[model samples]
Target: MSAPSSVPLVVHVIDQLGIGGLEVVLVNLINNTPTDRYRHAIICLRGATDFKNRITVPGVSIHTLGRRPGKDFSVFRRMWSVLRKLRPAIVHSHNLPTIDMCVPAKLAGVRRLVHSEHGWDISEERGSSRKYNMMRKVLSPLVDRYVPVSKDIETWLRTGVGLPASKVLHIYNGVDTDFFHPAEGNLIPLPAPGFDLANRVVFGTVGRMQTVKDQVNLAKAFVELSRLRPDLMERARLAMIGDGDLKAECESVIAAAGLTDKTWLPGARNDVAELLRGLNVYVLPSISEGISISILEAMSCGLPVAATRVGGNPELVLEGETGLLMPSRDPVALAEALATYMDQPELMQKHGAAGRQRIEQSFSVTSMVNGYLGQYDQLLGRQHP
Candidate 1:
């Protein structure tokens, strides 16, 4: 069912437009989606609009409600006003907080409502609260389609959140292979100078240095690995890219472990694809995920990975084939996994090649963009026709 509007507007709602896998995917979605048929706009609830530069599509308006922290209902009034003004053909919200905008959207007479779950944050880590789950179930009728980025989340939606199986559409985040493919010869300079990339086995991970990401754990593991294998110190280095509140904590851990010189924390980077090329191995030290775009980008760049077994990481990282997976929050287990790659450098090439092949076979950006477009078309046809 496709809507008849010449260019139907789609309003995307989220808590913040900051750095994260979810925000990255949204940028990719907007950039790749056909512009002639659809117009897109963003509404940020908490107003972290630092990543707006990522949006390349022209005329895509960004709005911030400036909602105060701690259960702000006044944001809904602002959202309602925005809905009335835009009159979007579709209201698509991401994550948990923005889902409430569906209430105002429905009241504003927007028929097409779509919601996506990008996995839990530190707060609702174990699962959604009883009150939150009940609220979701109550608002379930307002959502025309529910897109969960992984099968794990699809199950959570179906059983835990009480969403019907038919309503949940599982879509894995995709990577732009053209932009993130393997480096030719250090096209991007390393942030940490004096380290020899040709000789050193650079192990790196890119993400916001937040509690849920558990970058401190990666720092600890790297320090332990350094202690366990002093001989490999000349050949191994660690890079923790991206920045957040927990960055100081990561620095403290590295310093305490006597690894301040061994590790490089370069804060947030714009040239991630080039940065991915500079590393021999990629790591995802997240406590939770919904098919991480960073892991996919690393694979696309032909870099072998060492990630936790939590969330959708197992779905992406095949044990011993593409990369090794260890238990979450355990520095010892993480160190052991990193040690395997450090010792068996030959495995790095094999797994790195396999990872790129995997990306080409199933996780290309085209496939992900098409999946979202198909859902949009379905929602439009259902609502307008």
Candidate 2:
């Protein structure tokens, strides 16, 4: 299954290509890799959304299996057929659902099989599912390498899923600092409608409006903060970007709280870098996370963060230095964390500078791309450790 030296083909498998941290990293990896050394393709087990357009690299093939609603066993057969034709030198699957293709990939004669665990859903947030663990055990021998986006996920692989520590590689997700850097004054248009760039101090978070993201909690906290601090309400605003199944519910929470005007709920957006530049404080209230790319982007944009102390958030945000961390799902705690910035606006500037410095020192996109390339070369026997 060894590919020719001219250009090795690598196929990435994922549940879907949509607005997410993992998808953003995948796009960056492909766009940054040299075209002369590697060619790329993608296989979406379910289907790909318009987010597929983000891949600016030319000559990359995209395919979809169109999985059905429940128990889509046929996708494995389809994967086998596709892999037989593509004959990729390496087949890399992402997250839980995409891990099913590893066996089919090995059977189809792929040169190497790699799997990545980015984050988890509510049901199996800790990767402790017995069924999934059994499945991983059955497929473990076939996988050449395991890539976890964060150390938390790597620990789950070793302790919860029974993976050998030697087989797991921890790669921190990186941000494109150059693209997400702070803007000059009020140059970028404010994302929300009512906020004036000159007077308003905007606090924001970007991600899908899902239950795990807890945008409803953010709405509740924003309302409480507005009620408690009437003096700051005139100039304070909350912007919740990115849409999901919970968008309507989150809007309902805001409207019910009688603070619809104080909050802005923009559906899925593409101009995140511009929006991040205009934010005064960044907040991530997710009940669960796995090294959020939005957090890194916000930090890179020179904004202080107030994120829930869950998953790999603590790894990115140093408490009281880059941003404040609080318990998840508690509106009071979230409001208080946001209120700290509203109280002493100077801390935002101080911590924001520290956050930008942190990103420059540790989470540059070049570091992430090189980490993946090193792993690929190691598994391909092109590099000796």
Candidate 3:
């Protein structure tokens, strides 16, 4: 391990460190990274929650902008103040809302600025809209390096946003295999009520209950599956994790479908690895994704995945090998895929084993941390030399 003197002060800027894929990645980076090689800090534009407690590293500072609901100019002023005081070597911003931090970071004399594109939000997914593309173009110069979590994102930056391919680097999100591995023995603990593991084949998914994630579609698919195969009603159950604007809407759908007993909406969960192990199969019915960390965690837990074919999901799940990949927003396809696993027990075991092997070989947390460290070293070397 390199000494603290050799390490640079790296600060991460995010919109809100809430319960989501990006937040999980940020937490993992702070927790798993060696302090000897990287002194880290986090800045949340709209304040942070108990999620900050997840970072176990000592001496890591966290600053929240405390911006209100509307547009706040004070965010920029606060960012500048923090940057000036900390004098970080790199200001790494994630997603679009936080991307604006690069401007203040640049103004504050931060030497290197890195912007990571996790995925497109609902508004950006409505076919490239000229206004958003223009904004990206205007802000493109502020970032020194673009870190896109998927190849699709890199392609978008190059073709859609007209960013240089040379500056864009593709880095897939990783999962902690040790922390999220398959549960020993057979008994797994349930984190919420209404989920009885003794008599049901638990089908679970972890994601924000938002429009982009499309939890409504997952509910529709589950209800359709129950209608088609009444036998599964006796053995199958749905566990929808995470909470968002659409939770009440999703609950209403479940009630209408008469799946109140078969489905459980436990909101956002902190013990993801344990929750993943409690399930027999893992599913991600997202309309869009950028290498979902939940999918990786599930795969690492030795659970077969059934994910929508969008964004970086295809790269993580190898279709029939690791898990099945169905078209996005298609309830029939999603239900059919889920039904296949329900009918075939051996297939689930085979696919789940393959998924675990894939994660161990390619997507380990160590590899991800080292990849970011390599990028930091390369950028710093170029600056100093």
Clashes of each: 2, 0, 1
Model 1: weakest 10-residue lDDT segment is 186-195
Q: lDDT for each of the candidates?
A: 0.88, 0.88, 0.86
- Global lDDT of model 3: 0.86
lDDT of 3 by residue, 239-325 (tens): 888889888988898899888987878787777778888998999999888879989999999999999999999999998899999
Please report the TM-score between candidate 1 and the true structure: 0.95
Q: Identify the runs in model 1 with alpha carbons over 4 angstroms from their true place.
A: 1-5, 185-189, 382-385
Clashing pairs in 1: 1-381, 2-381
Q: Answer with 1 or 3, whichever has the higher lDDT.
A: 1
